[model samples]
Target chain A: MDLFEYQGKEQLRKFEVPVPEGRVATTADEAAEAARGLGGRVVVKAQVQVGGRGKAGGIKLASSPDEAKDVAGQILGMDIKGHTVKRVLVERAGDIVSEYYVAFLLDRSERNYLGMMSAKGGVDIEEVAETDPDAIARVHIDPLLGISDFHARKLVFGAGIEPRARKGAIAMIPKLYNAFVGLDASLVEVNPLILTGDDRVVALDAKVTLDESAEYRHPTFAELKSAHEVPEQERLAKEKGLNFIKLDGDVGIIGNGAGLVMSTLDVVKAAGGEPANFLDVGGGAGAELLSNALEVITSDKGVKAVLVNIFGGITRCDLVAEGIIDAFDRLNMQVPVVVRLDGTNAEQGRKMLQEAPNERLIPAETMLGAAEKAVELAHGGGA
Target chain B: MSILIGTDTKLVVQGLTGREGSFHGKRNRDYGTDLVAGVTPGKSGEDVDGVPIFDTVAEAVAETGANTSMVFVPPRFGADAILESADAGIEVIIAITENIPAMDMARTVNYIRTRGNGTSLIGPNCPGVISPGKANVGIIPGEICEPGPVGLVSRSGTLTYQIVHELTQRGIGQSTCVGIGGDPIPGSNFIDILEKFEADPDTDMVALVGEIGGDAEERAAEFVKEKMTKPVVAYIAGVTAPPGKRMGHAGAIISGSKGTAEAKMEALGAAGIRVGRNPTEVAEIVQELRG
Candidate 1:
C-alpha cells in the first residue's frame, strides 16, 4: 500500500522525525488558509502517489497567501501522468544548507533490510547509482540487531556527509528506521533530508509503502486506502474480500490459487481471447462465495463469458461445483460459462456440473481444453 | 531416490488440532506418510487422526522422533512456528501459511540461516513436496504423481499439480515434485531443488516451473548450465500478466525489468533448456526428452 506524500510525512512526524510543518488542503481556499497558519510563505505540492511531480508543474513556491491560493488552484486540477491531483499539500517553506538522500527498504538483492544514504539528494537515486555508484552508501542491516548508532555512523561517513551535520544525521537516521519498523513498511525514503541554515536535519520529502500483510496490526493505515484510485469492480471485490483485478477483455476468470489463476489468464490469452478480470476464489470458496464471484463478474459489462477453473487440494471440487450451480440459480447472469474441474473429487464435481442441463454451461476435460472452450465461447458463443 | 522426503521421513504437524492442520494432517497420513505426531501448544492430550498431539515441538520430536515439520498455522504465529520447529531439530520444514508479513519472513529466514543448522524449509505459502509413491510430506496429492525418472520443481501449488497431472496423463512420470512457495523470499529456491535432482540417481530428467518475480529462475538456469547433466524442460508462467500487479503469488510480479517472463525465458533458453509456453507444452517437451 503506497502512501501519499502528506501521509508519509505525517507518519514521519509520528516517529519524531523532523519534518517541515505541513497541512493537506483539498481546495484553493483551504490552501490559502493552511498557508496563513504557516506564516504566509509555503510550497504547494500536488498530493498524488506518482514521481516527477516537480517536473509536472504540480509543485510551486508561493510567497504569499494569494500565491498559495493561485498555485493550489492550478495544481489541484492538474493531472500528473494519469493520476489527477485532487489535493495539494501546503508546507512551510524552508532554508536549506544541503540536501541529502536517505532510505530504509526491504532489499530483494540482500534479502534483508537495506539502509541507503547519500550526500547527493533531490535527484533520482538511480541516476547516482548509474553515473557514480560510489556516491551512494548501502548497508544491509540484520533485522535482529536493527538500526544502531554504529550503523548510522558508518552510513553517514560512508555517504560522505559533512562532519558538522554528522551528529544531526546520526540522530535522524534511527528515527526513520523506527518509523520503517514500527509501520511495517517495505520502503521508507526521505529524499532530500535537508540541512537547514541552522544545521537542523529535516526530511523534506517522504515515500512509503506499507506491507498489507501487516494490516492486522495497523488499522490506522485504513484511512490511507484510496477508494477512488480503485476501479468499481476492484473496489467491490475488496469489499467482498475477493482477490480480483479488472482487465480489458470479455472472459471472466475464476480459479482456486494465484498461480493457477495467472496461468489461466495466460492460457486464455494464448488461445486468442482476452480475460475480463483476474479472480482467485482461493481456498474456501463455498456456495455464497461462488454466487458473489459470479455476480461480480457478470456485473462487468465487458465480460461476455465466465470461466471457472478449480484445482482442488484442500478445496473440494464438489463444493465449488455446487457453488457454481447455486450461483446460476441466484444470479440473472446472461453470459456463457465454461467450467474446468480438477483435483479432489473432481469427477463428482464434473458429474454435478454436467447434470445441469443449462444450455450456457460448458465443461472441458483438460485445463488447456477449458481455456480453448472459454476463448471460443467468449469470441462468438452466445446465451 | 528423490530429494527432501522419502520412506524414513517422520512428520510433525504444527497447529495440528486446528481446522487446516487436522484436515491436511489426516490427508497427509491417508496418503501413506509417516505422520508420527502433532503439536498444538495446549492440545497435547488430544489425538488427531490417531496421531498423538504434543504441547511443543521438542516433545513431539522427542516422542515421535519426527524429523520433518509441516506447519498450517495462522499468519501471525507462522514464523514462530517455523522457528520452533527448526529449533526442535527438524531439518526439513514446510509452511503452508499465506499472508505472513515479509518482515517476519526476513527475520525468521535470517535466523534459520545463521543458526548454522542445515535445516531446509520449503515454503511459507507452498504445496510442499511429494516423492511419488514413496512418501508425501505436505499437501501435494499422492494420486497425480508417479514414480518415474523425471523430477519436478515449482514455485506454485496448483500449477505444480497441473504440470504433474499432465505428466501422469501423458505417461511422463516424475521422481519427485517440489513446490518451493511463491513468497518474495521462500526458504528454498529452484537451485536447491535442481541440485538435489541433479544428484539423485533415480532422476534422469527434470521439469522446472517458474513464474515472474525474483531472479531465482535465472539463477537456477545458471546452476543448471553449470552443474546438471540431465535434460531439463522449463515453463514460465505470467507471460501475458501485466507489470506492477502481482499475479496471484506475492513474489510473482515484474519489478522494473527484473522478474519478467521474457527475461526468465531468455535466460533458461540460453542455458539450453527448452522453454515451453504453457504447462501442456512443457509436458510435451519432457515427453520428447524421455522418449
Candidate 2:
C-alpha cells in the first residue's frame, strides 16, 4: 500500500500542492534521463515501501546526470529492508528553510479520524513520539461535521507554521483532508513538507495507504493495485477469492475464520515453527473452498510443509477433513499435511481423515504437536 | 444473566431474505431465541422462519416489538444497516459481516457518539454472543457451549471454542461467552461487557481471551482493575507473530507500543489480571482464580 515517492507526489499535485517535478526510473540509464529532465541537479531516492532509505544509502544527491546514473546503479537491484529496489524517484532538489510532518489516521477509541502534524519532520514519527510527544499536534475530526476550516486553522497554528506560511498551510489542510477522504485512504502523509527559502511550501515526500476494503467504490484504484506488494501466495489466493496472508517460516496453515487463523498462527509459532500464511476459509468452508485454499498454499515455492488446523464448531470438522482428503487426492500432494481437528464430532472428523490414504495424511493429537510434526517433516526428518 | 442476548429477548434479523440471514434466523429460532420479525427491503410481505418480514427496522420493531437485531447485511452497506437499525431504536445491533472498511466504521462509531445514541454493536467481524442455556445470536457453533457461572469473552472465535473446550474438559462451565469480533471497531468493547460480568452475581469469575491488536485489552485490564471484584483470568494469542504482518486479526497488527502481545500481557498483568500464555492454560488460570 506504500506508494513510491513519485506516485505520492503525483497524488499531491492533484490536490494543487507545490511539488518538485519528478519521474520514477527503473534503470540507471532511465535515472540519468530523469535527472536530465529535472535540469541535472536532482535527488535519487530508492522506491521501496519502507522508510529510512536515506540512512540505508537508498537516497543520494547528485549534482550531474552522470552522478545520478552512478547513484541509481548502486541502488538498482539492491535490497532495502528486504524490499528489492525496482524503481527510483528522481526529482529536482529543493532549498528548504524548514520541514514539517503531517498525516491523518483513524483513532479507534475516540472513534474519529485524527490529523497529526509536527514542526519536526524528515524523521520517523516514532522518534518524535518517544522524545517529545508534545511536539505533535493531534486534531480529531468528527465524522458528522467533517473537517472544517476552523479545525484546519487550529492544526496549522498548532503545528507552529510561521506567520508568513500560516495562510498557505491552512488552505492546503482542507485540500489534503479532501484527498484523504475522497481516495478512501487509510493514511495520507506528507513528510518533510518543506518551506522554500522564497516563502513557498512544497511537499518533498509523500506516503499514502489506500483502504482496500473500499476498493469496490473506486474502480480506478484497481489500476494502481499491484499483487507484488503483498506476499506471492496471498496474491494468488486473493485472485481465487480466498483470504490469505503470508507469514515467515515453514508451517503452511489453513484455518476457518480470521480469529481462528490468527490463534493457529500463534500456536504454531509457540511450538517453534513459523506460519507460512494466514488462510481463513470463512464460515461453512465447503470442500471447494478447502481445496482452493490447499491448492493456493501448495502453489507457494517457499512453503515446506502444510498444517490443516480446524477447530470446527459451526463448520463441521468432518467436512473439512473430507475437503483435505479431496484436495490431497486432486493435487497428489508431495509435502506432508499435519491435521489437527478439535470440536463438534471431532473424533468423527479425525476418523474420517484416518480413513484417507496413509502416506500424506499425518495425524497429531494437539495443535502444538501437529505444528511440531509439520515443521519436523518440512525440515527433512521422516514423518 | 447475559450481557446482551437471552431467551427472553425478542430478536429481529436484518437482511433476513439473504441465505446467511435466513439460515441463521431459522437456526436461532430453532435454538429457542424469540425471533419475532425480520427486515429486508422489498421483502416486507414475506415470512422467514415463520417471522414476519418488514421493509424497515422501524416497521419490524413496531410490529414485532423486537428490540434486538442481528444484522447480516453485506459489508458495503453494513454501516447504513446498523445506523438504520439504531435510528429505529433497536436496543442492540450485532453485525456478523467481516472486512468492513476502517473508515466506514469510524464514521458509524463517530455518528453514534455524536448523536448520543447507539445500539450496542457486536461486530462487523465477529462470531457474536451465546448466553448459554438461554439463546445464541451469532455464527458460533452452539453445541460447544454450556451454561454456568464463568463468563467467557474472546476476540477469536475458534480459539473461544478451544478455550471453552479446555474449560469444559476441566469441569468448568460458562454462563455467557461473548465473541467481541476481532475487527478494529467492534459494536461493543471488553469494558462494555466486563461491566455486565462484574454486575452478574451468577458469574463467579471471568476469562478474557485477547489477541495482539488495538488497546482494547489494555483498557479492559484497567476496567477489571477498577471495577471488578470477581477474579479475572486472561490470555493473549499471537505472541510470536512478526510485528508488521497482521496475524489475521485486522486489529492485531503491532503498531508502535500499543498492539504487541507483550504490551497487552504487560498491561493485563500490571492491572492484576492473571495472564495465561496460551489458550490451553486459560482454563487453568480461571480455575486457580476460582480458588
Candidate 3:
C-alpha cells in the first residue's frame, strides 16, 4: 500500500530521520494556523499519492500565514491525476543549499534490495539514470549481511555529491535502508535530501510503499489506509476479507485463485463480454467466504451477470456450490448467474447445483462454455 | 523422464499436521505419488494420513530417504522451513506458502545459492510441478492431465490447469507441467524449466504461460531465441490490467512499461514464437506444433 506524502514523512520520522516541522490541514484556516506555528512561513503541498505535484501547481511557497491560507485554498480539493486532494501538508520551508536523491527498494530481477543515491535531486530518478547513468550510484545489498558503512561510502563516492553531504549520506542512507527493512517496505524514497545552512541533510519529501501482506505484523499501519483513494466496492471487499478489484464491465467474476480469476476475466472478454471486476475467493474458501464474494460482486451496479469459475484444489467445489446456493437465498441478486465447477468433488458439486435449479443460475459444462454463457447473458443475450 | 518429479520422487511434506498440509498430502498420495514421511515440529512419532511424522526435516530425510520437499507452512516460518529442508539435503523444495515477506525470500534465495548443494526450489507461492500420469507434487489436479510429449511451464496455478486441460482436450497431452509460482522472486524461473523441457526426451514442444510484471518473461524469451530448438508457444495474461494496479498476482503489476504484457508479448513474438491472445489460442499453437 502506497502511503501519502505526509504519512510517508511521518513514517520516516519514526525512523528518527529529520523532517521539517509539518502539520496536515484539511482547510484554509487550519493551514493558516499550521503555518503560524511554523514561523508564519510554510510550503503548502497536496497530500495525494501521485507524482508531479509541483508541475500541477499542487505545491506552493507562502511567506505568511495569510498567503499560506490562500495557497491552501487553491491546492486543497484540487484533482491531481484523478486523485482528489482532501488535505494539504503545511510544512516549514527549509533553507536548501543543494538537493540529493536516495531510495531503497526491492529489485525483482536482481532478487535483492537496491540502494540508489544520486547528486541530482527533485526529479524522476529513472530519467536521471536514463539521461546520465553515472550520476546515480546504485548498490545491491546482500540480503543476509544488509547495508553498512562500506556500502554507504561506495554510494557517497559513486554519486559524486559534495563533501559536506557525505557525512549525512553515510549516516542517513543506512537509516533509510533500515526503515525499508524494518517496515517490510517494498519502496522508500526521499527525492530531495536537502542540505541546510547549518550543514544538516534532511528529507524534504518521502514516498513509501509498505508491503500489504506484512499488515499482519504492523497493526499501526491500519491508520494509513487510503480509504478515499479506494472505491466503495473495494472498501467493502477489503472489509469482507476478499481479494476483489472492481472493473468497468458487466460480467462479475469469482474464482478460487488470482490467476484463475484473471484468466476468467480474459475469457469473458474473449467471449465478447467485458469483465466487471477481478475477485479471487482465495484458498480454502468455504460457503460463507464465497457468499461474501458473491455479495460483493453483485453489489456493483454495473454487474449485469455473475460468473463463478472455481477450479477446486484445496478448495472443494461442493463447498463453493453450497456457498453460492446459500448466498442466492440470503441476497437479492438480480443479475444472471453462470456457474462452472471443476476439480475435486466437481461431480457432486454440479449435481447439487443442478438439483436445486435456481432460475437465476445457468450451469455450464466447461470453462469456455461458462464464459460464453456469461458473456451471452451479459450482452442482452437469451437464456 | 520428467524434469523435476517422476516415479522416483519420494515426497516428504513439511507442516504435515496442519490442515492444508494433511489435505494436499493425502491428495498427492491418492494420485499415486510415493508418499514417504512428514515433518511437523513437536508432532514426531505421530501419523498424518498414515504417513510417519518427524519433528524435523533431518529426521524425515534420514528415515524416508525423500529427495523432494513440499512446504505448506504458515508464511511467518515458511522461509525457515524451506531453509531447514534445504539444509537437510532435499534437492527440490516446492514451497506452497504465500505472503512470505519478500526480504525473507531474498535471503533464502541468496543463502541457497551461496551454500549450494544442488538445492532447487520451485515456489514459496506456486501450484508445484506435476509430471502427468507419473507423480503429483503440490496442488495441481492430477486427473485432468494426460501423460504425453508437450512440456508446460507457467507462473500461475489455475491458469496452468486451464491451459493444460485445453491442451489435453485437444489431444495434446503433456509430459510435465510446472507452475513456477506468481511471486516476484520465484525459486525457479522460466529459463530453468525451459532448459529442462528442451533436454527431456519425453517432451517435444513447450508452452510458456506468463503475466505482466518483472523481466522473467522477457529474459525467458531471449533464452528461447538463442538456445532453444523446441517450438515454444507462449501466452501472457493481464493484458487489460491497469498500469499501476496489481491484478491478483503480487508479481503481476505493470512497472512503468518495463513489465507490460505488450512488452513480453513482443519479445516472445520477435523470438520466433507463437504468442497466443488467450489460453485456447495457445493450445491451438501447441496443436499445430504437434503436427
- lDDT top scorer: 3
- List, for all models, the DockQ compared with the true complex: 0.64, 0.63, 0.61
lDDT, candidate 3, A1-383, per-residue tens: 88888888888888888788899999999999999998856899999888898999999999999999999999998999988899999999978999999999888877788898999998888788779988999899998999888998888899988998889778888888888998889999999989888889899999998887778788867888733467888989988889988788999999988877877888788788999998998877888999999999988888999999988877889999899898889997888889999887899989989887688877888888899999999988887
Model 3, span B1-291: residue lDDT tens: 988999999999998899889888998999999989999889899998689999999999999899999999999898999999999999989999999888789889889978967788999799998998889999998888999999999999988888888888898888999999988778888998899899999999999999988989889999999999989999998877777878877898886657888899999999998998888889988887777
True contacts kept of 2: 0.65
Model 2: runs farther than 4 Å from truth? A227-231, A300-304, A344-347, A375-383
Poorest 10 consecutive residues by lDDT, candidate 1 chain A? A220-229
TM-score of chain A of 1: 0.92
Model 2 residue pairs with clashes = B121-B187, B148-B174
Worst 10 residues of 1 chain B by lDDT: B249-258
**Against the hidden true structure, what lDDT does model 2 obtain?**
0.82
Which residue pairs collide, candidate 1? none
lDDT (tens digit, per residue) of candidate 1 on B44-108: 88998688999999999999899999999999999999999999999899898988998998888
In Å, candidate 3's interface RMSD is 1.5
lDDT of 2 by residue, A307-356 (tens): 98888766778788888888888997788899898876788889988888
lDDT of 1: 0.88
Q: True contacts preserved, each candidate? A: 0.59, 0.65, 0.56
Error of 2 at A342 (Å): 2.6
